[model samples]
Target chain A: MMDAWDDYSEKVMDHYENPRNVGIVEKANGTGVVGNPACGDVMKLTIRVENDIIVDAKFKTFGCGAAIATSSMVTEMVKGKSLADALEISNRGVMEALGGLPKVKRHCSVLAEEALKAAIADYEKNRRDISPAA
Target chain B: MNLIYMDHHATTPLDAEVLAAMMPALTSEYGNPSSNTHAYGHAARYMVDSARAQVAQLVGAPRPDDIIFTSGATEADNLALKGIAHAKDYMPARNIVTLAIEHKAVLDAARRLQKENVEIRFAAIDPYGVVDLDDLAAKIDKNTILISIQTANSEIGTIQPIREIGVIAKKHGVPFHTDAVQALGRYEIDVMRDHIDMLSISAHKMYGPKGIGALYVRRGLKLTPIIDGGGHERNMRSGTLNVPGIVGLGKAAEIAKRDLKSESERLLKLRNRLEDGILRRIEHVRINGHPTNRLPNNLNVAFAYVEGESLILACRGVALSSGSACTSTSLQSSYVLKAINVPDFLAHGSLRFGLGKSNSEEHVDIVLDLLEKGVRRLREMSPLYDMAKEGVSIESAHFSRHARGK
Candidate 1:
């Protein structure tokens, strides 16, 4: 029988145990929230973008180990990347960066991707509202 | 790091004395109890009979012959429900009344009977998981053949009023069956006093070997056999007796009966310490199940902002179980919790702490420290906690609908 911890990869455990950038980005231009408490997982992603480049990223998540790890990994992956490159980061990309997640935990990675998209969308909306003719 | 096991409701480590008693049966007493013509057979039969008496004594049965050994509680549950349902004497009665929060053993067996044209009526339970006696009595009719309820719940540890339910069943003239798997060693159960017609119990839950259990049937009660063969177990169950496991179970039962009072008091103290520490040290935690009418060893709590699996993983050395969707294969929270109308969020955050004989005050302290750190850490990362702190109404957040769609 598989022990509960056996389902997680070493990378997943490492990230879960030592999550990086685990707070909201101060004065962030964009913020995204996905998932909900009812499903037992939720994620909030915040980003600081300057000159169309992602300068800082942080997250707060309520979820299982996979959700926390994927949130941590997504934030790390998006930092220092251009907005276009960050937009291209998929759930599979987050999963791969952490070696691999159990099949059931794959959805947690999707939450990470959606939170990123929502954050970027928020940033774009803020820019559009600030200057309609940009 | 030494692992502290608080999941005793799942199973317990075999007792030293039980193992010592089982050694002779496992090594030299290798004989079929049915082979009455040989010395080996006589020895095995003697052990089996002694084990049966021990089990009978533990449950306050009138006779040892009333105990029918089986593989485990699941098998015994199946036999009880199916055997009584298929009995020619009660075939005309088609309804089996049971509680909605019963273990899957009884519920699934009842479901199987449903397919065979037998009606299965589930009675309602209170928020604390106690059966509503009035509702249960209302569900039973003239055609009801059996009323199955559990001695106690595994997830929340709510002890039912079994004797009252038994009296109701007796008044209705329907056979009462209880899955006493979780209550065997923790509580005193007398089949005669409780008015129970049949009861299922397992050994592993009481520090005995696995794959051994028994069903206590009231004297003079008639039921059709679920398994048919050489008419072992009074023609009710037929199989070669498991000599070693039986010996272990008997020894375990003896130990349990000897230590029942003192052990329960000790476990109750540990459970209270753990529960009190969590309630005092943690924020937004809700205790589940009955406050006073619960099992001495069980403490279930739901931390407001943290997911159960995350909390479990964060507390690495403490072995526990959760009623969270994340911990289950079907991605659904505990049905027992749901049956009691615990909200989805709280249900997802629920964790069960089943204290056992091996636990000590030092162990409880360590677990408390771990739980405090884990819940605090997880809450720090939880967006839900942030919203709650900011005075946002969680029920109005509208993210729950999106979660359900997944």
Candidate 2:
């Protein structure tokens, strides 16, 4: 009955329907939150790193369907990957993961990529602060 | 199953009688109304004239020739604003005064004129979108040539005191043009009686076919033509007459005029039921426009802390507009709400439900139930609600705090 699901690849639909790592991580070592008051779409990303790897990543997005799906895809892509590899995850990569979004909804995926980059940047800043010699 | 349609402010279904009246024009009797010396033209002209009479009767115009046909309200608006702006006597120094809450057709036209060195002044509206009469009066000067205001706002459904505003424009000896697109046929409008110099009306708004509209230019008011062509619409707008569309419009006007009283009463009851049902069932909801001074078929409410898009998605069975149908495609906040000082948080959560010919008590009940459920669910997950419950005002949260440089 929901044949429209076929437009999306199996992987994209899986992430959209059963999103992974969905929610906020409280008082985390690294957090990135981006908000667009205009469209009322907001994204908050939290990361926990052990060694040089992204040990855990999670996200919460308050937006339309594309936005929520994009954030979910971001979390799934970043998981089990090194912090540098996760930081390299691009908006174009997210779009490719989800087939594609309507032109108007492309902003949603772009926001997810920005949120992930911000989180990685925050983690690097924290590491630099902790290391007295730089 | 009983179906309900709440998009009356959008194009309405053609009345059966209107369709009957328009059949002849769409069938064999079609002819160019401008063509002379032919039986076809005579019949076509008769239908056109009859439709004009029907429209004139509804508006209480003293004569039928005062009405000029164009495409719908958007075209009418463009013609009135640009026509007046380009009149040879029109001075660039003369500012155009209009309210902030006007339809974009008018607002964007004014913006275009401003680019051509026409000074445009936007009068402020109160939080409820009612133009401040004092602020409007203060903005008028000898250099002000024209003022355009919508008779009723399409978004909030708030009715401006156009008659009062018309009096003010007359006092200042400036021409007043109203975008009566939303108010025509629903309300009584007479160019002379209302002291209006020019008015814009759309056919599709009152169950007429799309691509047909009319503008009321008071007789003897000389304005330059916006469309340069074969001297159509008394040279104000030049284009081939859309005979079929005009026939639909005329038939719609006739039916709307005949049924105005009873239909208005019925719409008011349905609208009130919808408003009361939702308010009684839902918490933290506020009506957007003035209660008494609004369209009988409109009920706009701000569902505090609930995302409007989510609520719409949840209630997919009923098709209704959030704000302007145009802006809904874009995920941006409603400019009308932002203009009237609806805080960003509440503005994003606002919903517009326009009642029309098809809504009923049962439909209202269904909507109310769905809305109650939708609002409760969405608000439960909203962080804004959590902040509000903790006694943190959104304004204080913004103005009192700045992110510490980390």
lDDT of 1 by residue, B1-406 (tens): 5688999989999999999999999998899999999999999999999999999999999999999999999999999999988884445658898988888999999999998889999888889998888999999988888999999999899999999998999998899999998988889999999999999989999999999999999988777888889999998889999999988889988998889899998999999999999999998999889998899999999888899999999878788999899988888888988888888888888999999989999999998899899998998999999999999977678651253355
Off by over 4 Å in 1: A1-3, B88-93, B400-405
Per-residue error for A34 in candidate 1, Å, reads: 1.0
Here, model 2's chain A TM-score works out at: 0.84
CA deviation > 4 Å runs, candidate 2: A1-22, A25-29, A47-58, A120-134, B1-4, B88-92, B323-331, B393-406
Candidate whose TM-score is highest: 1
Per-candidate DockQ versus the true complex?
0.60, 0.20
lDDT of model 1 at position B184? 81
Q: Give the per-residue lDDT digits (tens) of candidate 1, residues A1-134.
A: 33567789999999999999999999999999888877888899999999999999999999999999999999999999999999999999999999999987888899999999989999999999999693
lDDT to native, each model: 0.91, 0.76
Which lDDT tens digits does candidate 2 get at residues B1-406?
2345677777677777777877888899888888878988888888888878877777777778878898888888888888888883446386889988888899998899888788889888888788888999999998888988888988888998888888999999889999988887677677777788888888878887878889888887778887789997777778777788878888888878888888888988988898888888888888888778898888888887656665665464676666421125555577888888887666767788878777778888888888887676555544456556889774445311111111
Question: What is candidate 1's CAPRI-style docking category based on DockQ?
Answer: medium
Rate residue B87 of model 1 by lDDT. Answer: 83
